[model samples]
Target chain A: SAVISQKPSRDICQRGTSLTIQCQVDSQVTMMFWYRQQPGQSLTLIATANQGSEATYESGFVIDKFPISRPNLTFSTLTVSNLSPEDSSIYLCSVGRRGLQETQYFGPGTRLLVL
Target chain B: SQQGEEDPQALSIQEGENATMNCSYKTSINNLQWYRQNSGRGLVHLILIRSNEREKHSGRLRVTLDTSKKSSSLLITASRAADTASYFCATEWKSSGDKLTFGTGTRLAVRP
Candidate 1:
């Protein structure tokens, strides 16, 4: 199991602003993922943050709006840009250990409220 | 079995009683994991049941997987107030890369 932590436990921001949420892992991992969860809703995968290449985003998400950077194996960041009221949601970072079939450990999540 | 679906979206039970939540998926999976979230917060990994494994246990929690039926269930025995949270079931298929498809989640309220 891996321990993951996210920065800015919760934040309130104004529209059009950008917020960068960082994720740090205790162990090096191969696959990192970003997720968004609206209030009372299930989580939706945003993108896959590979160590050395561009992030692979899901069909409904885009990089311009949600850019990701995974400089190394243990850390990654997700930035929600040009935020809108609809963008207000809990952003989470999860990691999958090497060879671990689908066991993912999630960070506490950064709760963003766009006003 | 349909992908990412759970039954009895909400459950309320008194402390010391047992709570059970069921999840059903559409495809063949390598493993299925259970997670718990407190008050809409981040999820805590509870347990995992592989496709070849029929059942697993962790403390007061019990998980069962039925690949033939493509479904799984999570059971929490002797519940406490702290157990009053949302529980979700996530699946990872044999061919899908590291992506976990999460279910709708069950809101369990353990009243004292």
Candidate 2:
């Protein structure tokens, strides 16, 4: 199992502003992912943060809107740019560990509210 | 697109009673995992059942998988108030990448 942590446990942001959420893992990981959970909804995968390369975003999500950076195996960041009220949700980061079997561990999550 | 859908979007049960949640998926999966999320918190992995496994147990939590039915069920025995949270079933599709797709989740409220 991996231990993951995210910065800014909760934040209130103004519309049109941006916020960058950070994720750190206790151990080296092979893959890191960003997710968004809307109120009373399931999680939506935002992107797969790739180390030493660009992030692979899912459909309906774009890089210009949610730029991601993975500088190393244990650290990554996701920035929500030009925030709106619709962006208010819980942003979580997860790490995928490869061993005998693959298991993904999630961070505490960052709660962002845009007004 | 969501790969899994859980029944009973919300459930209320008394403490000490058992609670069951069902999840149905659209595609063939290599494995399925159950996770619990408290209000305003991250998800905690409960158990993982592989395609080869039929039933698995972890403490009071039991998970049953049926590949033919393309569905899974999670049963919690002797539930406590702390069990009041949202439970989600995630699937790792065989045709897709290793990334897990999560369902809408079932909110369980165990009243004490």
Candidate 3:
């Protein structure tokens, strides 16, 4: 299992401001994903951070709002642009094992609050 | 819409008793996994059962998959107060992307 960490564990930002969450893994991983969890809700996949390529976002989410960058195998970042009250949620970073059957490991998470 | 739906949204069980949660998915999946989240934190993967595997056990946790019914169940034996948290079942479809589709989750409260 890979040990993952996210920077700035949490932050409170003003509406219209932006914050970038960083994810770092102990070992190089093949897949890294970003997820969002609303208050009292389950996780929803935001995008798959692809190394050296553009991130593949899920439906209803756009890159303009959440831009992702995966420059290397061990690190990735998700920037929430033009934050709003609705964007106030826990953003988590998880890494998957390399194979057809996936075993994912998650970081603590970055709690974002837009006030 | 969530690909998976769990029943008994909230469960209250006493310590030392067994806790059971059921999950039903809407699509065919390659594998089903169970995860635990405490206080809305990141998910901790408990166990995973492939479509062909009927059951899987990891320590006090047992997971069963019924592909015919498109459902799965997670049972925690000898529950403890520390087991009080939200449990979720996520699905990886056979023909879908790499993302694991998550369910609504069941909030379990184990009282001492």
For each candidate, give its TM-score against the true structure.
0.96, 0.97, 0.98
Q: Kindly list the per-residue Cα lDDT of model 1 for residues A13-99, writing each as its tens digit.
A: 999999999999999989999999998988889999999999999888999999999999999999999989999899999999645
Top candidate on DockQ is 3
Candidate 2: tens digits of C-alpha lDDT, residues A1-115: 8989999999999999999999999998888999999988899899999999999999999999999999999999999999999999999999885333366789999999999
True-contact fraction for model 1? 0.65
lDDT string, candidate 3, B29-76, tens digits:
889999999997778999989889999999999999999999999999
Model 1, residue B6: what's the lDDT? Answer: 88
Candidate 3 Cα misplacement greater than 4 A, ranges: none
lDDT of 2 by residue, B5-78 (tens): 99889999999999999999999888999999999699999999999999999999999999999999999999
Clashes of 1: 0
Per-residue lDDT, model 3, residue B11, is: 99
Judged by lDDT against the true structure, how good is candidate 2?
0.93
lDDT of 1 by residue, B29-92 (tens): 8899999999878899999888899999999999999999989999999999999999999998
Model 2 misses residue B15 by how many Å? 0.9
Residue-level lDDT for A110 in candidate 3: 97
lDDT of 3 by residue, A20-113 (tens): 9999999989999999999988889999999999999999899999999999999999999999999999999999864558788999999999
Predicted complex 1: CAPRI docking category: medium
